[model samples]
Target: MTSRSAPDRLLSVLAAFDHAHPALTLTDISRRAGLTLTTAHRLVGELARWGALERDASGTYHVGLRLWELAALAPRGPALRQVALPYLEDLYEATHENVQLAVRDGGEVVYTEWLSGRSSVGVHIRVGARWPLHATGVGLALLAHGDPGFQEEYCAGPLASFTPYTITEPELLRRTLAEVRRSGVAVSDRQVTPDALSVAAPVRGPDGTVTAAVSVVVPHSGARVPALTPALRLAARGISRALGWHPPTPVPAEDT
Candidate 1:
């Protein structure tokens, strides 16, 4: 929960409905949030009244527009997505592939926006989707730019593999992260899905810290990694600039 008061229990109920389980019955929410049915009912009622949750005709609750509006205020969420949308659109237009924007939320990457192109490969990724640190291109880009301690802990993981190409080894994952940092971009070839490939570049903030990532996913067999890097990097830089990152001032020349 964002806060740790009695209301946190209710907020936790709201938090539990993400991309994976966008719609849940009261019982489902109660079990998932580890709250008793009575507690769940009470909290859900409060949140529904507050416009944070909405009950559908079938009695299942989904996240309400109110919460989505609140999440929009988060600088790392919709704020960033808004600044990046045009560039994201350009990338999608150029490649005719799936484009996405994501941020590091703890050890996972949460996709905030996605644009699917007509000819793109079939990918299960959706808005609000979450993926582990080592599984997808955007996830790897965020993980590679994260704090060292967190990176170490994540690398020492029982890494989940979505496909045979997923890097499940700690040492190998470390090396790959190093490469991504050095090259300023990441690529996942059939790592998350057998028929898809993704290339991602880190989006920086005003202070030059990596704040988000942008990526494009295409069909694995016909993907052109070499040609796609420039487009991805251009979009990343555009988003960073929109977020107020100015080019570093070049040092003055010495006296002649």
Candidate 2:
């Protein structure tokens, strides 16, 4: 067997913790990281000293605040969230619905910010939660604006289904994406959950490429899709403008 490098071994110990396993014992880290107890102990000590991991009173370790501090510096992650937050807050105030901002990562959409409204539908999404591109309104907006080749490849995938309403067929998903592009909005009708629906619009960058998506989730039973579309699109455009995107100016007409 090939030997793992020092950096790989160190990263493995840190990677042992995830959304599912947020804390771990020394033995658990050693097992999950495929390292010896002694090696795991050494690495964990270094990481703790560097503030990359923190140990609890029970001797279990969790990812530390230092990592979050570093992650905040990423332009596509927390930086984008900082720029989009005011617009998200405004949308939340206007609709009192669950407002979210997400960016596409591979075949999944990683939610960067979420504001829960007092009377919003029950959604289990956290800031870092991820969902497949075919299941959520934000995901559909992003997928619809993605590169043509990548979109084609994603539409041919083994799409995972969350609720009965989730689009599982490739052809149907393709059609839905087309409609999203034509209408400048995407609707996830009880797709993620049977009781919740979402309306989403694309957020573009200065280069006119889709960088993120914004959405509002409401109860599916009485969802006002048409009513929510304008607000969602307006908020998305505001965020895009904040990120240096401007709608193209029309060319002047020639002499008649």
Candidate 3:
């Protein structure tokens, strides 16, 4: 293992536990983070004392509520989620489908909120689940509006395939992103799950930058993408306006 500075090593131990590996013993954490068991124990003790991690009765540790509370302060995470939630609720009431809100985190999308659909299509995605930027509709919407360098790096595959329709080819993925930009929305039809489809639109910030995305997931069979598109777009635009986005003024034809 490469030698990391003490602070870096400690932070790595904390980073090792995410949505995938939420529960870990000291040994598991040490191995996953490439840290010595003693170092893991020391760092874990400190984190536990500070309430960043919680130790279970079985001696496993998971992220604590305190950490979740701290993450709430991040404007791009829970803060945005809180503001968009009412509109998300309205969309869910309208469609009775799975509603999700997510933001770009590195080359992946981190889900901040999820509302279960009554039909229950076997999608197990949770509040903190992450998926590649090229596969999920929310991820695509966020990535399409991201910085050029970040977008280029993300499009360089190692793209994961969840279903047959997932865009694993770089060229196809590139085309799909371009389309998202042009249409101001994204549709992932059975890309993440074979039976489910998702339609997503970008949520903008005060400065008009895409900060997050909202999506509705429904069964792919007999799906009406056209009908869902308008609802999703309206929800996204409502959230964007709530964040203070205003369209630029149009000049009158007489002025020309």
TM-score, one value per model: 0.85, 0.95, 0.85
RMSD of each: 4.6, 3.3, 3.8
Alpha-carbon error at 57 in model 1, in Å?
A: 4.4
Candidate 1 matches the true fold with a TM-score of: 0.85
lDDT of 3 by residue, 1-256 (tens): 4568888987898889976698999999999988889888999999999999999999999999898889889887778888999999999999998999999888889999988887856678888788888889999999999998888888887899999999998888889999988777899988988999899999888898898999998889988888998899889989999999874468322112
Q: Tell me how far the alpha carbon of residue 99 in candidate 1 is from the true structure, in angstroms, after superposition.
A: 0.2
Return the TM-score for candidate 3, rounded to 2 decimals. 0.85
lDDT of each: 0.87, 0.93, 0.88
Scored against the true structure, residue 123 in model 1 reaches a CA lDDT of: 79
Q: Which candidate wins on TM-score?
A: 2
Question: How many residue pairs of model 1 clash at the backbone?
Answer: 0
List pairs with backbone clashes in candidate 3.
none
The predicted structure with the larger lDDT, 1 or 2, is: 2
lDDT of 2 at 12: 96
lDDT of 1 by residue, 1-256 (tens): 3345786787679777876788999999999887889989999998999998999999999988998788889887788888999999998888888899999998889999999886568777778778887988999999998999999999999899899999999999999999998777899988888888899999889998889999999899978898998889889989989988875667212100
